[model samples]
Target: MAADEGLTGSSRVTVFAMFGVAFGYATHHLDARRVGDVAVVGPLTPGVEWGLLWQMARNCGRATAGEAELARWVLTQATRAFVCGSGRIAQFPEQGWKLEPGGKRVRFDSTYANRDQLWTGNLTVEGLAPDQVAQRPTIYTV
Candidate 1:
């Protein structure tokens, strides 16, 4: 009985050690490359997302009310970040970008406005000001 108990314990320890090694190797193999201008879309930290959303909201009513100006700015900044790989808006100046809520959709350009309702988390914007927008927050979709 004593010898049998020792064998069982040794087997359990060996299994655990093997599992640990496999987990470590899998993590190392599944590493992802860093993206420049894209907000990671997944379950994000609330504090970070809220902070970015608040800053954008504050700037929403600055030029006009009932206008999707905030949405437009968010999209533009996000696009720029994705394209340039810099994640820095200062590098790309805003060229009279405006966004209007088209029913459920937010339009991007001034002409030929493409209307598509924005599903929260599907698309998001961050960085509205020099100080506010620079703090990139993780975004998640429902």
Candidate 2:
């Protein structure tokens, strides 16, 4: 129904949830968990599917609220660290990065001179403050 309400493309339903859950009620600073252990219900993968989820939320008339905005930001960072190959896959399979348990990071991709394999065993967002980090991470892997 959201597509009729202006939703389309990959993971439209997931996008809708971003807005629906974020806007439907008051969300606290929660959802801290492991990346590998976390599995999205649909065909969508973590990190990559987040933007789509946000778009779906917009379609469903949900604005980025509470931790929603932070969630979006985290999604971007995750893409940089994992999907884009900036954190761990940087330098062509030589360097690597790891996020330890209970780790809270503001940024990951550009903390060093080279990109390394980014790994997060267990971590929580702990919530993001009102800040915008740099975007435009290079895609070194599929």
Worst 10 residues of 2 by lDDT: 7-16
The TM-scores, one per candidate, come to 0.31, 0.21
In model 1, residue pairs whose N, Cα or C atoms come closer than 3 Å (at least 3 residues apart or on different chains), thus clashing, are 37-81, 37-82, 104-117, 105-116, 105-117, 127-133, 128-133
TM-score between candidate 1 and the true structure: 0.31
TM-score of model 2 vs. true structure: 0.21
Query: Per-residue CA lDDT of candidate 1, range 57-136, in tens?
Result: 44643555443565554444434433453333233222111111211233334521122222113111222233422223
What tens-digit string does per-residue lDDT give for candidate 2 at 1-142?
0111111111101111222121100111113531122211111222232234334424443354533333344344434434444332112212121122321222233322121112212211212121211122343211
lDDT per model, in order? 0.25, 0.24
lDDT, model 2, position 6? 14
